[model samples]
Target: MKLCILCAKQRAVLKRPKTGQQICQACFYHVFETEIHHTIVDAKLFRRGERVAIGASGGKDSTVLAHVMKQLNEQYDYGLDLFLLSVDEGITGYRDDSLETVKRNQQQYELPLKIVSYGDLYGWTMDDIVREVGLKNNCTYCGVFRRQALDRGAVMLGVDHIVTGHNADDIAETVLMNIFRGDIARLGRCTEIVTQGESSIRRSKPFKYTYEKEIVMYAYFKKLDYFSTECIYSPNAYRGYARTFLKDLESVRPSAIVDIIHSGEAFEIKSTVKMPSQKTCERCGYMSSNDTCKACVLLEGLNRGLPQLGIGKESRVRKQIAESEQKELPTVVQHFSQIQRDADAPDIIQPRDPSTVYTPPPRMPTGVLDPPTKKTLDW
Candidate 1:
């Protein structure tokens, strides 16, 4: 029996994209699936013995990705040792609720699922971090920390490559965000299907060209178990703007998104905007362009009373910290953190009064600092 792509109903709409080759929705889905499978093979995203960890969020995109990848790998005999890697962000109702779906996914697919969480490594879950940092900064910390957590998990799993459920819409949204911010290098790198050579594990996005709507529909037709809750603290204004803009465009023109991404790959840049070289984080030894990665920097902010770690916008971090010693007063009393810090306000260095026993700051043995000589300040 033939299938319908437009509605997934038994009856067909007999329509394809206004542009491009004429194919039914079912046929289009097959095309999407075949193209994605071929893309993975052509890109050489997996090797015979190497472990591949699918970044499962228990959401639609991930659910569909895991399903499709599992099917293709076996059918094509890709020789991939597929494992599921889910990073629990620990949002009370959001992540806590969603994680159940991941657990169920393990049973449904009969794939070995490894769940790693922020609470385990950072001693702070999204819930705890949100309580201290508030909703405004929750997603920022979660996203940054989640990236690191995934890498760390892959390390523990001894996997060499990590595949995320990042679909075309997400990729399109990110591209627009980077372009709007004038981040040429990130814009160039963000579209990369496979990231290799730097981090502990290589990361790739097999669904990089798939659409979110199609993924959701695929999950629905397949009747796959998935968690359908937005993160409780997903309050990123910048990314929200990009998402809204993309959705608006998607409504007006269906192929607008895929076309945009293809153009992103196709567009040639004559300018010399080289991507900054990545170095290991001085604190955590993770791959980063700066001396310390964003994750390490945010971790420092949380330990200190710095507001900037929670808030990534330099303007807002500066505004909040201008009142007092914000995020940048050293996290060390007697030792130095490995972070190559941004310029700190100079006023905080005066030694406290001897009578007032100020507790030493969080200590990191970075080994490059002049020792703090305690010349007691007058009370």
Candidate 2:
């Protein structure tokens, strides 16, 4: 029975599943963000007078997220200095176009925007990582480095928490991915809105229940601008398959994605599963189960041209790390050997956080790179 705020056209959007008071779709978009702002305030997601940053990519999800958060700040009088935080991945056509969108976003929203480039953060772009690691699992490198770089950027900006544009579809895909991988520990903690930080800056996903399609629709109807380019080296065949599966399933069941999110929330893991110990990585100071993080290990491997440090279990990758320091084994061999070790170490393997599902990106025929993909293209 709620009326549209725009043309006074009343609609049936009153059944929006209780996101802290539902309104029409137009109003819901506005109210949903206000709800998130209140949730952040009530949950103390940010300090009363702290600086906050939006992980702006100039994409629809991010652009909508940034705009809503800005409106909420003004309406609710949230006492936080907000800005846009972007990563320039240096993929030629992909990221350059995205960065252009971010620039436009800065002017449109009147928010201070900051860009942290991979060339500046790690001295290697996605192009460089692909050239070295190839298509098999280079995503792991992009994921790890981009995460660390975001924190490093936030640290430079002196912000407490970084908000991403991740919505229900992304979260659902991650949950499925973790479930498929049997990462139970991650599954248990994936829906955590606020990731408590010990070393790395805190992070949160405010739009956890928002749908990607809805976000796109909202942005389109609202005429909010965003970047729409795909990454050049997105070759995750497995994830792509999963995404297709999800899309097909969604066609059959309209609420399949949200249902999956609920399943992730409802399912419980056995108490006997031992979770990864909370420890700090000595090298990078991020949360880790062992002495160093995967990022630290991979960086060490890259510096030595030993791919082994980038993959495998703690003990196994540790051994590879040690071997790289001493012997001259092919790092790729050492890397797969760690996988065998990982296969054997079932005790350490836990279920991934269910809220995080993996969606395979659309497949690209491997040939030559046309437009350089930017570093921040992945979900």
Candidate 3:
């Protein structure tokens, strides 16, 4: 067998996809971890004493990410208080099974784990949403809700930054998806290593440049336990087409993944383009591109028997709303800021009693009622 390319010692084991170098297991591990460390350092992804939450999905990428984040935090003296944060979308047999893996990882890595569920946060689970919306457009509710759920979970954890396991291939697929959709705004920013949410919670991808193959190899050789299952609801997602296309290109040229990311990074939007401005959601106080956040709009649709309210053109949704008889819209259970405050002092209030009756207060003249102090029917 040929010797390792880097050490010229042990026999070569596997060839890396990014560099096409044959190396031993030890060398592979060293380079894999080193490259990620460099990415973090070069991007200045963390502060010395910041509390960081790893967005653990119990999948291969996330399981590997939690292990590596803990390893690097200790080995390089990153001084980061790392925690595992997971969003429970309440998908039966899928998310439920995967969370068990995350729980085991929490124990193995000895990091604090916080799980926020859709049922608890938004009063609607994935199963329920799917049942209501059917197979079509169910992903829209999930994507919007999960994004906000993670942010809210991070806030409750009081974390300074949230890091996900989005790898090079994932980033490349996203670039292709944005280009195909002609989403100029998302296309311009999708390649960024780090992004700040409207709430100022920083999110980064430490594995932004890491290959998915390498991550799989590392997990396999290390004998790490991780869940490997496609989300049952995402079989028809548009991103799947983009992913398949990118993989085809990668089969022809291994460098296609990194090249796509670099291309996205280099592509600049013209100043004349009109980008959506960020605003605070009037309902929940979350940052949104519209007056109401997508989550709120979707929930409204679900509650009002208008599941397509946020699925298509805003003008059509408005027309539908105007055509229907006016009814009292649901009020948010709690404000985002109030939730943060409650998180800071866990004993300040008692949990809402499920037995209590919910009466929708009279609608304000402004039409946007303030968040109810008591829980709503959904809650």
TM-score of every prediction relative to native: 0.76, 0.76, 0.89
* Candidate 2 lowest-lDDT run of ten: 337-346
What candidate 2 gets wrong by more than 4 Å, as runs, is 1-44, 198-200, 325-379
Query: Which of candidates 1 and 2 is the stronger one according to lDDT?
Result: 1
Candidate 1 regions with alpha-carbon error over 4 angstroms: 1-29, 197-200, 267-275, 310-379
Q: Rank the candidates by lDDT, best first.
A: 3, 1, 2
Candidates 2 and 3: which is better by lDDT?
3
- Assess each prediction's global lDDT (C-alpha) against the native: 0.67, 0.67, 0.82
Instruction: Please state the error at residue 189 of candidate 3 in Å.
Output: 1.1
Candidate 3 per-residue lDDT, tens place, 27-130, comes to: 98999999999999999999999989899998889989999999999999999998888899999978877777777778788787888899998888999989
Q: In angstroms, give how far residue 265 of model 3 lies from its true place.
A: 0.5
lDDT of 2 by residue, 27-58 (tens): 65665565667666766676657678899887
Model 2 scores a TM of 0.76
What lDDT tens digits, residue by residue, belong to model 1 across residues 180-291? 8888767777888988733447899998877665565456545677766666576565688899998888767878888778767765655675667867776666777777
* Pairs of residues at least 3 apart in sequence or in different chains that clash in candidate 1: 5-25, 5-26, 306-327
Candidate 3: stretches off by over 4 Å: 326-328, 341-379
Better of 1 and 3 by lDDT: 3
